[model samples]
Target: MVRISGEAVELANEGSLPAQEVPQTSITRSQAVKLYISHALSTWNARGYEFATILFTASAYPDTLVAAAIRMTIVYFAMILFSSVVGRWVQKSPNRLRTLLATIFVNRASVLAGAFFWLLILSQEDLIGSEGRFSLAKNDTLKHILFVVAMSFGIIERLSASGNLISMERDWVVTVAAPSGRPYDLTHLNAVMRRIDLVCKLISPILISVVISALDSVRIGVVYTALTSMVSIPIEAISARRVWDDNPSLRVPKEVPPEGETPPLQSGTMSWRTQLRQYLHDSKMYFSTTVWIPSMALAMLYFNVITWRATFITYLINVGYSLNTITIARTIGSLFEISSTVATPRGVEYLGKSYRSVPQDEHESEVGLVSGEDSQSVRDTRTLVGLQRFGLWGFTWQVFNTAPVVVALFAITAPRVQDGGINVFASRMVDRAADYTLPAPPVGWSIVLFSFLAISRFGVWIYDLTTQQLTQTLVPSHQRSSFAGVETSMMNIVQLFAGGAAIAYPKTDQFVYLASASFVVVVLSWLMYASWVYRQRGHLVHWEKLGQGLFVGGR
Candidate 1:
């Protein structure tokens, strides 16, 4: 006797069906693959552009190393400011997709403009007199303006890339399904994306090198920029279109909670002060999760180490290593990264299973699962899993992975070592030749150093994957964006301070010592915090079988 509309009938039928038996309206497998490809291409283009910009800046400036570092600091600072504003706007705006698309367009336009300016400057080399050239290199005012404009564009490009990543994550949550008609597991999806990302990283540097070689002239770098932009921008637009068309409901503005209900944190209607407090509170909660703060600290240290490596790369180029050779080395490193990426998911899974029992039928909660009254035991299991996964020894291994670079830098710059007395591994490897150019180190030493770099790179990649998985597990759905934004902002602030320190003491020894001391302090602090966590939760720990299935003839 009840009057039911067609929609109500559909809903009633849907509710009657079992979860797995119900058909889902989600993205097709082909569409998902295409989106992944687009993401990789976008990352490639951005990295290529950055590489070109660094080389261009170094070639144009006299104090190349220090200038590039300063320029990088400015870019980081700009991205921090821009992302904070834009992220808030996206969260609050009714038209998120449109705003995202418009931002992408603006980022591409800025890249084009920056490329044009670089071309203009490079092409005018013959026309500029000696005085003009000197001014171009040494005039602080002109140099500052040029770096600011160029880096601002870079910041915009990075922000746009981040927006795309967030969109992709959201799309997967809302619209993606497993090929077997089951809910998508974030761990599996992240593994696939990481492998693709590694493959992209492997190919992008070689492609960039080829482009640079083909162009031959710095002025022609603009052509490469335009080409990459054309490829990436169109793909992004198409992906956005597909997302909207395939998931029409995503376009609908999210409704506010009823007036009587408790308002969600970070709601658009909240006062600015309220929002700030919420952000801080959310950040604290997120970082307080077992081992997250230290894991994050190590990640930040790795990022800071990269800037130091960039400065080192500039030094190498100044002292006669061709840019091509450096690019080739990086490409080789990426090959190793592919292996690391492939192993990470399995490693995390093994550790999780070994340390604690993860529910096999819990894919729904795997994406944005949070601790609840009924799930408190599960949360405890996950907390113990994290503790065992990245306890004191894990943190130490991560620190050691990247410590060799600092050691190598110290050996190269220390006065005693510079005098060529240390002979255990050929002090000449660190010594400057008579011509003031650094000589190629012995092949054995080169192998050791490159091995260190490769291992460090692998460790960092694993850490990144682990942090992401933990974040997905710990953060609730409603607070994900707020937490993500706060974490990102905090990382940038830390990097800015680190970058400022690097700029202040541009000398190799000074930089290495400061970096080493900081790294040690972070690792020790993490170890202490980890000890405290272990004490609080140690009683929960239990032994579990390993290699049981394989040995027992089980599938």
Candidate 2:
């Protein structure tokens, strides 16, 4: 038995529905709005602080790009290694709200301490002997240690938060919304969340630029971080309590069945290995879809090449542009990203609606339903529908996957001429110059490039959302965290190799070419695998059906 909004109700038996309707346990619209606001605030503050810290560290370090890369690698590696344990703990915790709050506190505290230490180090430069100060500054081992500590705390916080969100969303879907016969509308919800995220991205760059320009010290950035953290901490704490109050079962620990008693079928008590095996067996299509990881890794390596080739800040300075100019450009790009994200779901919805309007014969073909005795028109309609769906998913994957490659290509091929002691380029076509420098490209070119990058970013977000929905569909509630951990761990393993490769050959054209070729091979392999899976499964590998089941229907 459990309490929902002060009403006593028995837990629904697995695979059965009671004759009487279960009172909705889903969060009210008001509660959801509040949760969204709180989450947005916390995420924005956390991400802003992180961005500021990275920028500050880059400014302080000599090889800024390499330092950033190494730090990011360390963070991802830590997440990969620790996520499984963290996930299991979250699932088993008696008081999940407390657990989540504690993690957030620790994460913020660690970052705050690191910021203070950084300021302390800078302040003590004159007090320390020249040799000692030089050693501290030159090696930067202390800074690295600080970053590792901060990032470790961040990993725990993020893992806890992810588990909490999934649990809440699951409860809302399975218990509340479905029973209440309401449309889930996941796409719309996602769009709302993403819109908030985009706003944060748009604002963060401007804020950082203003701070950096005004104070000319990284410490000021820390102030913003601290202030935001203070606000976010309380809001998160309040939200956690509200969640617990609304859903007491979430706060209770799972009880093991006594000896000689039959355990609940839905209990997620399988060994980690067994769970992983089962998940893989059930999600063969998903696994096939992820064959793009190696290609993604190669793309990441290509990205590093472009990033390190010429630091964006250095390039801007060399091009006779102010820091503010770069910030403005970035802010505009972020706006574009926001717009694209906001628009994409509408576009997809429109396409879905349009596709549904075909003749019944065509619709049956689109959905891969055909009889041996079907007419020629029906078969042709089916073929067209199949092609449409295939093209949609394929285009989506390519758009998301090709971003880094496009950036790399732009880095290598953008026209350039000599200017301000560095290579520069103009917007229009130009003759090859002895010195690699050119006049600033047309404003339109900059806008186009920025928009392209923004669209790519949006595509990545969509891809992530799609995969997350798929995972939520495939994994049971109790096993969600563990499954997420395993998936993240696998991805990190691939990224580790990619990061290592990039670090080993930081500046090499051959490496980029090799990576690109590897990406092409992996992509081709993925396509073949997808085709095979489609033939076997009779449908393209996608989350659309799952989405429909979860959102459109109670199931």
Candidate 3:
């Protein structure tokens, strides 16, 4: 049996009522707490590897923007190539626990291998050079070869890590939270998971950057990452195993084929053309769904080169900013993002309360639905309406909040007369600012730039959480990871373009162009999201009422 409720479809057994009619097993408070803790540990370990890789690129090749671009582009390309494959594998896997553990093992092993390769590169560098700079000896060929090998390992690591993320964040969290007879658990779980991610993102980079900058040796940073990742493997595994053992529902595979599509034939028996056709059909399936708008909007945000990312960090280092200074500014931005995670749940709760307080007949009359519908379906409709409203609200805020970043870039990079003021110390750079021994920005202007960037993260994360939850709540179970993997690939494709832009304008003075281009993409993303909201307005709560409730109410 199938039931439709305001853009979402629920399926059940042929003889049974809709799945929403069945009594769900409620999770104990202890079990909920354990899930949150396990998710935090696993997310922290995953983000450790992610941030460590960024630090590796930014620190190891501080003076070479082109080298950093190449390495980052390679990682993005690897995700584009392998995310879908990993997604399909996870969808077909019978044992989620074994699949998750094996994926983590591969990710950890690749990190260790990359570290070994980086050690080789460090060995080839001359130790008697300038502080915090890696000057190679006459053997350029050997160094290039070692760089390629390290990036190869990086590709493998990113592939497996991307797979792990899709499995956990996209699939398992929803599966575990939805059937627990609690509507708010999914939102709370997403918020806490993202909070843990932000926390790790803030700490790992700072620690790695401080180690490399203070010690003046990239080798030490590499060793520290390798050792910590080695220790974290067992801990992450154990936490994940506990969650899996306690939730028997997670073990049962969800394999409902998508409506209107035939099941795929055996891979070994299909011809190459048949496989190609199947792949195209799958692509169309994703694009045809309502979820694609949010997916594409989020992906468009990645075509940004001027954000607080690896390329921008590399640019800051090249422009004479100290690594310690860069990490401190990023930590400030992360704090705002962490707060956004907290704010998101409150916003969700506010919307839920407002929607639930509406009279059923009034809601049904406004939307042209029957008055005597099942109460569960009515609840489901209200939930969908709330998600859609919040998604639109978040997007609207993001559009306005991101505009300041472009202005900040233009102000910081403007050509002006050299002023005699407090000089910020430079850590890594070749072209020191004229009239100053070290390349440093005027202290006041530097703060403004960092402040604009930091504040923008508040809106960015609110939108991120809303869009992610909307996708999680709406997408079908069988296609969750596959859809998420494609979504990841799309975002990386845009990021690849951003990396290419950095390669084209590989100097600090030419950063304004990248910033302008990124803002234009942000506007375009807002338009796409706004259009989706307009199309779904019929099923959503009244826009004026929702706006008044969110903006005007003291509650």
RMSD in angstroms, all models? 9.0, 10.6, 5.5
Task: Please provide TM-scores, in order, for all candidate models, with all chains considered together.
Answer: 0.72, 0.64, 0.83
**Runs in model 1 with CA error above 4 Å?**
1-27, 62-67, 93-96, 126-147, 170-184, 247-295, 303-308, 315-325, 355-397, 403-442, 509-511, 518-555
* Model 2: per-residue Cα lDDT over 313-426, one tens digit each: 454444445566666656665665576556544444432332332334532322212123334223322322332343335335544545554454445434443534332333
Write candidate 3's Cα lDDT for 1-555 as tens digits: 011234433311111213453234444566566666655655665666677666666555666656766777777877776676677677666577887888889988998999998876775544324343454563667877888998998888878877887778876677666531155366777887788878876776667767877987777888988897788787778877887777766666555455556335455666757756655655675686667898899999988775777668866775557977986888788899899899886776566544442444542332211123455444444555555666667666666666766676666666322445432222123345534444455577677778867887787788788888767766666677777777887888898888778778766667778888888988888888877766665443454565467573554
Residue 3 displacement (Å), model 1? 50
lDDT of 3: 0.68
Q: After superposition, how far is residue 248 of candidate 1 from its true place, in Å?
A: 7.2
What is each predicted model's overall lDDT from 0 to 1? 0.53, 0.47, 0.68
lDDT of 1 by residue, 1-555 (tens): 011122212322221223343344555565666656656666676667767787677655644366677677777776555444444444444554675577567767878877766654544433244544322333545545666676677777777766655544533333243421133344456656777766765666556657667866555566677667766888877776676556544555533223332224443566767655555554564464443554465445533544325655644454334777666666667766676667654554444444333334342133112223234334334432542353433345456855676566455444323334553223334554533334454444445555666665666556566556544434442334434555566677777776666666665435556556555655664565455435433432333433342232322
Candidate 2: residue pairs that collide: 365-382, 417-437, 417-438, 418-437, 423-436, 424-437, 424-438, 426-441, 427-441
Clashing pairs in 3: none
Best by lDDT: 3
User: Of the pair 2 and 3, which is ahead by lDDT?
Assistant: 3
Q: Residue 50 CA error for candidate 3 (Å)?
A: 3.3
Off by over 4 Å in 3: 1-6, 9-23, 54-63, 125-139, 178-184, 213-216, 256-279, 314-325, 356-379, 417-448, 539-555
Q: Would you give me the overall lDDT of model 1?
A: 0.53
Model 2 vs. true fold: TM = 0.64
Better of 1 and 3 by TM-score: 3
